[model samples]
Target: MTIFQVTLKNCAFYAHHGVFEQEKALGQRFFVDVVMDVEAGDALGSDDIEQTVHYGLVYELVEKIMTGSRRNLIETLANDVALGLTAWSPMIRRVEVAIRKPSAPIAGILDYVEVRVEHRN
Candidate 1:
């Protein structure tokens, strides 16, 4: 079986997702990266859109999940994205999701806090 991957990186959104009340009240920017492993049996030869995973639809789904509800942990958000993407298509064998919180509520100087989740179907 031939496998292909579709990756969406650094998809940005602003949402309320944190453990603290202040963090919830004041939303911060989040970045999401998704990688979907797909079976490309005929897609490579046929070059048909329907044969392969549609990234536009994937982006929409990711956006919906990112902007949908508030979660206390980015891990939960990442897991949700992984599960959601794996269920979106039967051709998808695995999904990897990463959520990054750049403005995490920390005292010291840091770049970001990120969580990564992977799901297999």
Candidate 2:
């Protein structure tokens, strides 16, 4: 299967995503990463926007997730986003999304909290 990749790296969003009540009440910044796999052959020759996944639409999809309501877990959010993106585009055979929280409420020091999800159609 030929593959085409679309990656949106280090996207920041202000949203409530935590289990604790205070955490939900006070929203924090979260990062998102998205990648998509598409059949490249069809668009390889023509170089037609119509034949491939439009990058603008991908951005819109991600924006929607960022602006949407609070979620308890990034895993669920990532999975839903990946599945939703693939479902919207016929050319996409699979999609992968990663959501990261840098300032998680953890006592221990860490760079970030992240979850990755993959979907295949």
CA lDDT of every candidate: 0.92, 0.84
Candidate 2 residues lying further than 4 Å off, grouped into runs, are: none
Q: What TM-score fits each model?
A: 0.96, 0.91
Candidate number of the best lDDT: 1
lDDT of 1 by residue, 1-121 (tens): 9998899999999899999998899898999999889999799999899999999999999999998988999999999888888888989999989999999889999999889999998
Candidate 2 residue 54 C-alpha distance from true site, Å: 1.0
Q: 16-66 in candidate 2: lDDT tens per residue?
A: 878888779988888888888887867878989888899888888887876
For model 1, the superposed segments whose C-alpha errors exceed 4 Å read none
As a TM-score, model 1 comes out at: 0.96
